[model samples]
Target: MSAQQRRGEPPPLPEPLSPLIDAHTHLDACGARDADDVRVLLDRAGAAGVQAVVTIADDLDAARWAADAATWDPRVYAAVALHPTRADALTDDARAELERLAAGPRVVAVGETGMDLYWPGRLDGCAEPSAQRESFAWHIDLAKRTGKPLMIHNRDADAEVLDVLRAEGAPETVIFHCFSSGPEMARTCVDAGWVLSLSGTVSFKNARDLREAATLIPPGQLLVETDAPFLTPHPYRGAPNEPYCLPYTVRALADVVDRPAELLAEQSSDTARRVYGL
Candidate 1:
């Protein structure tokens, strides 16, 4: 059994009121290693109305896995990047390999890469802001060169993330993956035509600001992601997250915007397809 199952698996929520795409998740981290394993996971997600997904990478090996996983099922796609937290890992050899993978079939976005100040101060394997800035810039350039959407991972470094984006000239498609900021940041992003991809955090009682941000997002600018194997939605916050758990977050978001879950799902799924060209 996977660790998630061992940790007390919660059955996938009832089928979503409408079909939705899990814009970001990690099949490898969820212990899905082969085509058969991926099929089982996709089967569960399909049963819950998550008809498609974009599994994201945080490092070279993960990127390689993501590219291959995308081929395992037509329902699956991939995004490749060295995560902000692991920015320092983008070595010369790694970059070339990543470039090769980014251009590979079914690799849609060039991210989950941005800045994170939440890690310990520039030591003990934690990347310093300088290294992260350099890496973020590289990823930005790569996204532009590849003509792929840039999926950003901002954590406690919103200002810096914006600064680099502005300097680099935001990509035609920019995604604030797992948006954890407040109204001010939300407005800035929306005004710039950047997409806000909300995770399960919006369902947390303490995330009043994030919930409010959701309401302000325009229909086409909104997207949903599970960030699975982490950030599981409320009522099961600590349970190992997976694409199948996406319905819970969608329902919570619908409540936040006071719209039917099906409507929100359709809108977000449409935007997801446009952004990722699914």
Candidate 2:
């Protein structure tokens, strides 16, 4: 019995009955923002059938917290890397620290790193494309050296992203975290054997392209994520998103792929565990 449900509480609904894994999230960021809010979030998520989550921290501060959080719970894992939008804070010292943290046992991957041209203006330290490229390369190299999967966060700069990744040949288990792209791009990534992780955005009525992307991914390569505290699914789109709300997104993904949610949950969860080597 879980805390959310009492013995007589309608038998707890069975939680959609699937082994689902949220491949990308920011538990520490959301948790620290509200003073241990993540624990309640994770508890709710567990009740909803999410077996595990990989929380990513894009900066040093977030990295420290994520590492510590993972230490506190086996269901939580961490990924340390500088996000594209935060590329301005890049320093040799920061890189060194990230590298050190990446070596930690809980650090399962090396990213949330990539290009983000969607911002109105360049992020403070990442104003130049060259510097962003250099930083991306460094992270890629780190992934290779560490033998960890590389998680990516792509924005408007798809072409350059493809170019850089192709040049670098990407790590073996490359993933497009929070994948929000069109059909053609999804096809490209799928053909490249990259994993495409869908988030709450897929549940949007207007996200036709992303829904199309869901159709292209096979069970072995598909994944689901919350990217929590942001991108809450429909019906709860405006509320604070946590892992508990992930089922809504998963249900939406099932609709896109024309499969039942239970099977989709099993497939996506298995795929995610394989990718993260869990």
Candidate 3:
């Protein structure tokens, strides 16, 4: 389906709360092609109390764009890496470029990297499992060397991802962006001092397991994100998502964890700032 057809309508903004930060998003994929577009999106977010955002890169071109996009606005930061599906593209030249980008002033993390067993057999051109593991390990080392957080993107390969992290020795800060696992994994990550960045998926009516997991996470170990242009949250599930929509997820998370929305928002934002070193 085309983007327009898939994104039926932009959801109405939720009521503003304490300042929040969207720990993960895709400004380029969300249709912010230039500085002005970036400003417009961020302005909407700011009005809804979203103070900052971290745009994530899933490939070489996106890594370059994310690093540059961070320069577009003070509120924007970046995380750079090749997605597991595109691990084959991480050639020697690409690795050198990513190393350079990871050292950029606005680059805050090295990630969206980890195992993705779900796509290997189902999606054409998806990287083989072996390639994904090799690339994930390289990205982990890059994160450690750069002294930046490791932003992970795990999909149906939780065990494999954890095993690789154990083998490679995880970076000081590891974030499971758009964390989709249940309470068991949540406990495992929390016990290991890794951050779990929850997304709109936690708000779905059918996400009882995720909601349960949310209750298990300590405020300092938790975060909120839009992962926008996807996972638009419950009421607006099929609609296009953006940073401005973060308040909805924050409120939903507050409900799940039985905390005041403003307090949760503040805590999550603080966690984001610390994790990204913003």
Candidate 4:
């Protein structure tokens, strides 16, 4: 291979896949080129053994698009809510709109919501903690009213997020969509009976915190997700992620917990079904 080819290495060989769910992904963002594009993506995911998928939309347009996609594909499900960063974007009219959307067939969960302090100073109009808190509260209420799990996305705001959740008496089955927190938070979440959905970062070379957290989590409280077109698991780290790439993450998770990959797959899938009501 040439020098350039060698420098841009491909992901490692994928591990054997087991039946699973891409519990959280942005299918609207990844495969919206056309219907055929979506079909191809679904075909690839199906071939890789992803029995189901819960596609999340951070805004009204994305939510409507995701619902339509689910209509086109039986394997895809939908979740509708304003993301933390875009919380202010939601209008009063959206309440009724989302209520209708949530009632759609296979529409499950109410998130990709929660506090995001990672880019506190960046993103105009997003640095305010109160705004994110209000959004988080709205989502919690949405979950309660709709009877759907709240899929969370916490980044650098763990303590405050937990505090709000506790104060509000959040739903019984909240999920930390892309659980990137350390062992301390993991223990608290597990103790609270919340599901921690692991992502590609678990397979990264320097993800010691994630590995430690994984070790402490009970099997029933654990789940896996690709967060596709985002956290592509190791070996596929630099490439666009898809549901098919889930096995690489599963293999890493299995290694961390010292369980067989197949068992992890089954347990995580079961956990996803139970949490998301899939």
Worst 10 residues of 3 by lDDT: 1-10
Alpha-carbon lDDT of model 4: 0.82
- Residue 106 lDDT (model 1): 100
User: Candidate 1 residues 61-170, lDDT tens each?
Assistant: 89999999999999999999998888889899988998899898699999879999988474578878899999999999999989999999999998999999889888
Tens-digit lDDT track for model 4 on 15-73? 44768888888886676555677778777777777788888988889888887888887
**lDDT, candidate 2, residue 166?**
87
- Scored by CA lDDT, what does every candidate get? 0.90, 0.81, 0.93, 0.82
lDDT of 2 by residue, 1-278 (tens): 34323332221223454577889988865654432565666676788888888989888898877877777777888899888777767798998999899999889999888888776364445546676777788899999999999999888888989999989878888899988998999999989898999999999989998888779987888889989867877756666667766788888888888899989888888888888888
Q: Candidate 4 has which clashing residue pairs, if any?
A: 11-235
Ranking by TM-score: 3, 1, 4, 2
Per-model TM-score versus the true fold: 0.95, 0.90, 0.97, 0.93
Question: Considering every candidate listed, which one attains the maximal lDDT?
Answer: 3
Backbone N/Cα/C clashes per model: 0, 1, 0, 1
lDDT of 3 by residue, 163-247 (tens): 9999999999999999998999999999999999999999998988888999999999999999998999877888899999998
What RMSD does each model have against the real structure?
2.7, 5.4, 2.2, 2.4
Q: Which candidate model has the greater lDDT, 2 or 4?
A: 4
- From the highest lDDT down, the ranking of the candidates is 3, 1, 4, 2
